[model samples]
Target: MSEPKRMGRMGRRPGHGPGGGMMPGEKAKNFKGTVRKLIQYMGKYKIAILAVLTFAVASTAFGIAGPKILGQATTELFNGLVAKVSGTGEIDFGKIGRILLFLICVYAFSALCSFVQGWIMTGVTQKVCFRFREDISSKINRMPMKYFESRTVGEVLSRITNDVDTLGQGLNQSVTQLITSVATLIGILIMMLSISPVMTLIALVILPLSGILIGIVVKFSQKYFVAQQKYLGEINGQVEETFSGHNIVKAFNKEEDMLKEFHGTNDMLFQSAWKSQFLSGMMQPIMGFVGNLGYVAVAVAGGMLVVRGSIEVGEIQSFIQYVRQFTQPITQVAQVSNMLQSTAAAAERVFEFLGEEEEDLTAEHPVKLENMEGRVSFEHVQFGYRPDQVIIHDFNCQVKPGQTVAIVGPTGAGKTTMVKLLMRFYDVNQGSIQVDGHDLRDFNRSELRENFGMVLQDTWLFKGTIMENIRYGRLDATDEEVVAAAKAAHAHRFISTLPGGYEMELNEDASNVSQGQKQLLTIARAILADNPILILDEATSSVDTRTEERIQRAMNNLMKGRTSFVIAHRLSTIKDADVILVMKDGDIIEQGSHQELLAQHGFYAELYNSQFEAA
Candidate 1:
């Protein structure tokens, strides 16, 4: 089946804290390094980012001018009141109206600038996210199978979904916030200094204290953020595994065990999340307290200066506003610092996935076989999933074109591993595998796989119609051809008996159809593929005896001239004129015709007799 479009919602959990855009405790292993790589990744959008920064600065600067200009109006009104009370002059209503109008225009201009920057930043962020998803999708196809085998589906999927989304949101918000916060800090400081130097110094003194507190909070909260992110993936994996195998879980009566495991992971996630969020949440209050302290100092110092006739009354009011503005940016910067840490953490995961070792599919000079005879050979082949543990040791085989080779063995006999090697999913650790005298490595992987058709034990039917699923085997095949193939695999009758015939839509897991029907569809798909080499691993194991008989005849017709490798446990079905390789452990102990191997009565006879006896 196709991969789930949007998997579990691990990020959005119950009891999540406010300002949930960032997980503060999640710090990157290499913050600066990750940032540098992210910067490089976004290099193509440099001009757009630059424009966003410029407009953000302009917006903040224009906004910063508002309070100072409003102070002028306050000063004029105060002077007019004084003059009016003395009966020397009346209030300058026209001048005051002009100042107020000017303040409105300044604020309006600031808002316009903010909108432009936000629009541009959003576009840039979306473009980067799109590119990340595209690159990751392409990367998955070229990566070795072992990489996926070593990790959970959710862990890998998290790179594309949660991590990319987090990076995009953090980039959009933090970049603008950082620029505006810094600009506001600088602009407010200049305005405050212009009004009164003593008050400005008093206000600036609180910055060091705020910085120290933020640093302390960040240091203590970082590990928890890391833990939270880790557990989030674990929780997602656990959920995916449990749900996918829910039938097995119930069959085994392990609901309590599953709940216990889930609760354990959920508790870890909750602990880390609460700790990190709580620590980061402390920043706003601590900065507010420091800011209020700065406000008190600025007010006292400004009042003393005003009494000494050093600063105007309106100027003190503006300085107090500036002190408030100053502290706000500091708080914003602290919040942005946490956002940056989260951004770094998410970006690091994306980069790590991108940097994984991809399979080199391209051969220096690829060999193209115009007429593939399907003459396959394995010479002293040796392989293992890992280098230290050799599973298939000293395998030697040769097959002429149009021969059917039945591989019979107990489980863990390296039967499937042989198929993997032949398909070049993993290269052999020693010796070589060849087709028509050319080493598998000499041909490009895509071209090599193009010549083979596979009907796996686990059938994969994506979310589509039965016709479309069968058509997946040969994308260019017509409807008539698909029908013919289905008939050949004895899938046409059952499909016609279904409600929608070939037009029925399969769900994500294709669970509407029976396991046997799914197997028939996959066989139909392989038949439609019509490749020169066929690999059928338990192709008829799912059907009943009657259906199996029909499918066996269809399979015989399908494998007539093609080189087929049939891996099965049902020895009764494969007692034909073909070579049989009997294996045990990891070695092929017997190789001959069915009768010859039975006459020898080695592992093959033992396995063959045991199956009928059990039945």
Candidate 2:
């Protein structure tokens, strides 16, 4: 059977729409640090970035020059009309036509520059996102099992998908907008000042007021934006859990409870989302209002100067257009703070994951297993998932080469923990587990793991053909070898009966096959591996008695001349084991042959007899 998927904690939730922001309960504490690191990532594409900047500057310059040049046409038209009214000269239609053509060429050139900048920036954003995802994928392998144990698949997936997407969007849109806004603001200020310093002073009065207003709104909105992203991650995690475990939920009749929990998170997300959107949405209108006020003041003041013969009407027109252009960038600047807040929040989550403690892979003079005899020993081993509380304490065991040892116990006896420790999934807190006189820690982890084969109770099968799944045990195994292993494990009969035979494809979750069939495939995989050591955890518990008998016969053949550890809930299966170790509460309570333990009438005997009595 497929493994039961684990669930994670549900915190604040985000909106239902894709890419909607929801606030997290905790904000990213190191916002500046994340931003600095993001900047450093962008530094890798310096030449492309420089080209984008150059194009943006050119685009803005051409755009900014349009209104001022159009003002000159207005001035010429006004002068020509006055001359015609005075009967002193004819209106200069040729000059006006030339000015109109120049304006069209300038605007077209500006559009081309903007398009090139956007195209280049898109490439930059995609390349950077690619690098970020690559690093994250590599980092996942280096991380310890404890990291995955503490987090959920959904939470980790959210970081890789949603957070990386947020960062990419911020780079693509926010970065370029920031550059354009600042450049436009500065260039317009210079144009306005050059036209008339008095009108420029009037426009300057509104700048501080606008800044203060934006500051207040952005200050309140930043927290919500941060919360929005956090909630988004939580919502994603909850969705993943609920969907993966939908069958369990239905079996347990938890529909109402699940709905209630989802609604609670959804409501929290709504509250955060609306507030963030509302505040950010206010910037444009507020800036527009302030901008219009500045426009009126500049127009009225410029009109008085025009009447006093200090400035021309065309210059006033240009100054008013400059004032409008100036306020747009201010509005964009205000909106960018919200975008930056979201980016920083997403970056912090990703960076926090990337910065998690990786397993210590360092070994001084690492040993390699050559001609492995599979003589295993545990001497004074101690361990716990957490450091403050130890579970397995001072455990000791020894197994000779080619011996079949069975470990029997009730649930939570740390049976699986022992297997994990032997495979170096978790390092022991005290003493050592050794293979052939060398400490397991001293051996190179990959080489050490290669010596053991595992057939877990929860069989894992990826989306592939049956033949391909069997070949996973030995990547370079031939098609004939895979079929031979399947025959040895008694999986070939069932696989041949399927419509496509060995070439039958499994679904993503391998749900197309029955539970017993999946188990048989896993057995076939293990048989193909041909490792010196094997760990079988309830390998046949999911199959029928007849199938179990077949599997036991196959396992006996596979276990010949190999050290094997069998973990079983069914006491009858391990009756012929060389040694049967009975455990409880993380420590072994008894060890002997099956007949010897039965004679003692202790834990093993009681456990063994209970199965029979229940049957």
Candidate 3:
């Protein structure tokens, strides 16, 4: 079997490198820039973010005061016990009760603040995510067709779904955690310094060392995170391809091959994922160890101070709690680096798509199509899909108001490309196409496209009822008009036989109906559009002879007085055309009536004879 189509290089345009593998040492480039832009997206929600921050600070402050206040109760109980042991005083149960009640209130207030902060931030995160998705959706429409041609559907979809999700989760969880952690760190530090500056110094010294270690781990883990995201996109592309083309894979007995390829991609993703997680996982344990050492040092120093009566037992107790709280936030701060790395990687992909060059839709006083007569002309049209290599060079063609132009050629002979240019899907590199003597570039693209109707060999139908799918051609078309269009295209008979007729719902893939039925539905859609110019790209190629005859008759009626361009593979279909232009290697090698071409006995005659011989 032919080698499987190369799944292009991960994270780059296809066909550039030797083996389509990622370059070595490829980290998430320009991470800071990506992060800056991501922050800008959040800027719109500043008021909500400020409220979250206010609640977070309030919660952390209350929590920080609880440990110290609880220490006050400990001191009170200690003094009462000592006094009772000497038989000089009784325990003050009332004072102790009051302290306990106040502690309970402090903790309760902290909990409420935390909850409020979470609620506000969650809404903000979702809104930010919604805007990202909205912008990406709009960006997709603004992009030129070339962008979609280069990228897989899964790749683009992953940006909207997976990448956006990653950004949302990171912003929701990490941003709030970072804020709380920093706030807690500061509060703890102040409490520790007030109790014992020496102990605070001991705790502070360990932090720089922990920071150095965290930096080292993060340096290694970030590359893996970038690789993980890249491989995720690749795996998504693989799954999309395999599932969409499952029938072809089974017909060719390529299941094992597909599985092997999937496993290879899966393994790559697994390796990067675990490595990133493993390195990040190391942070907590390593910080815990350093924290234990700091704890021991502070404990030893505080004990000596207590024995010397330099500090109270209650202060030492509060200091130890502050030490633990401080270390935890440092650990959280370190983990935020990892979180930020993943966010940057995902955001970079999304921003890259949004930054793609869009087609220039701007026109100054653009010409509009009015009273269109369906006249089209190509004047020395030079064009190519790529600029370095021109495909259709110095081509010329013209047609009057009422004519059927048949384009026939072998595969890869630029028949489709020529029509695509006429539609302005791709502008010609070095020539002009005119509709009604007005340059195509002079008119608005939407207005230009509205005047032409197309039905291709590959029929596209969305997940909707048959009537709705036909109505897609003209959104405002009435139900009666849709039915009339379907009847005109000869689609009404078979559609009526279905259980719900025009109201039957199609699944996402539109697989409920047969291929011919789908083509007829598309034809009905074009019929409803009722444009002055029609494009039929192998409109009946996939149907059986009887269905082909019916479709051909419908097309003939549809093409009655309009200018139509028919690209056909079957020689028998276009025998009665007003003109047949035979194409070869992007140039029209022969042009005349079919009979005239047969009389010439050249490339056109040989192509016609081959079809007869094959039959």
Candidate 4:
């Protein structure tokens, strides 16, 4: 929930250890970090925690002590009544009635505490759940695009929903309940010894063997449950991949291929889940066997004592009740163990996600730019998605302030990588990127990103009003500013025709709207941002000629006096660029204005010719 950790490079690069290589997942066993993160949630609700513990302890005491009192009262009454029947004394029902009243009071108090436990824990758990989800959302937002590219949306959703909700019983209730149950067991054991030590020992002999069995089940279950959670994540990934690309599946007639992948994931999940559940399922029968054996011991030993006149009948009854109390809590404790492990596995994943590297926030203090000129330069910058396969090696380029620089390149020419580095989504492996003569790293990630606006090929809009989507560019934008930005992006006319004008609610991903409209909305966002620098990544690829021309006019108005970097396969869009860099295979092969490149008739000329020829 606290501001995410800033990018730290003092030690090794992230996702690595002291070995200077990728650390395997199981070897480090960093589950403690996960446990600590969860337990920290308890801090905010200290008063609720205290209240739950108090009620649980009080309830346990009544549950344990009340039975013993009733037992003594019965023993005394039966012995006294027997004497009276033999004409030795008179019966005392009044004393017995008081014992009955005491038992009723104890039951009432225990029930009330149980109610309090449920009520307080409900509030505590719901609050923790909300905080946990909110912190995760914030964490994900700050993570670089690398994280999302590496993980599917469904796998992420599992941690937020399934994994998080598992804590409801295990996290909030188990702590208090486990403590209370253990205390109750101890109290019962001590009281049983009072009636007859030999009997108590005989009754308890089965527990050690039971503990061994429980331990074995737990040890194996932890391994299997961890596997189960992992497989679930895999299955979630498969589902996300299939559904998100359902259109592609149908278009390419890949339903069978998709189904095969789904079946593989489904089978793995089943095996993992069944193995984990089978181990846990064994606990109940084993617990029942141990408990029933205790019953046999108590009956045999208590009968012996009675025959020897060592204890009265009622004392024997009290011991039986106490035996059930002690052993039944064991069953509850075992169940708690099972749930806690599952919850911990989920917590590990959730905390692991929250610990991802975030955008640098150290430069909370920034010098405001009074007059901005958008000059951008990359000097000997090297970068990659993976450590081994470098995408951009020793790349260099320069743009004068307020100049339009267009980059034309084949696929994987590092055209997109160049823009990504310029935006500082991923830091370069070598050299420096500078803006206005200052190193980009020195400006802080947030302050640096805020200086530029970007429009990508694919557009994303939330399920909200159209006005809300455009206003995302500047959260504090006025209604008039939003309308003006929309007009500049040539979006206002289409928006006005909608039933609700700018207030129309869009579907998920804005799928209901035309692709061009979505692009316009994204452009409106950029227009509203009005930053001194802009990067357009194939902004016109998804639009028609008419729409592109309209957006081009809007972009020209937006780019005046601001540096703009445009990456396009369509050469027409870059014709007016002051400088065009033609890249191939991670290297810049030519650099000049459009006419200058065409005159030389090299890589840029070929690339330009190919695009129009294909069309």
Q: What is the RMSD of candidate 2?
A: 3.8
Per-model TM-score versus the true fold: 0.90, 0.88, 0.88, 0.82
Which 10 consecutive residues of model 3 have the lowest summed lDDT? 1-10
Say which candidate scores most in lDDT: 1
Superior by lDDT: candidate 2 or candidate 3: 2
**lDDT, residue 185, model 1:** 88
- Model 4, 388-468: lDDT tens digits are 988777778888998999998888899988887787777788889989877777776777778888888867678899999
lDDT of 4: 0.79
For residues 177-213, what per-residue lDDT tens digits would candidate 3 score against the true structure? 9999999988998888888888888889988888898
Give the Å shift of residue 118 in candidate 1: 1.5
- The candidate scoring highest on TM-score is 1
lDDT tens string, model 2, 289-318? 899899899989999998898987788898
RMSD of each: 4.1, 3.8, 5.1, 6.3
Per-residue lDDT of candidate 1, residues 545-568 (tens digit): 999999999999999999999999
Off by over 4 Å in 2: 1-27, 207-286
Q: Give the poorly placed runs of model 1, Cα more than 4 Å off.
A: 1-24, 207-286
Question: Relative to the unseen true structure, what is the C-alpha lDDT of residue 166 in candidate 2, on a scale of 0 to 100?
Answer: 84
Which stretches of candidate 3 lie above 4 Å from their native place? 1-28, 205-290
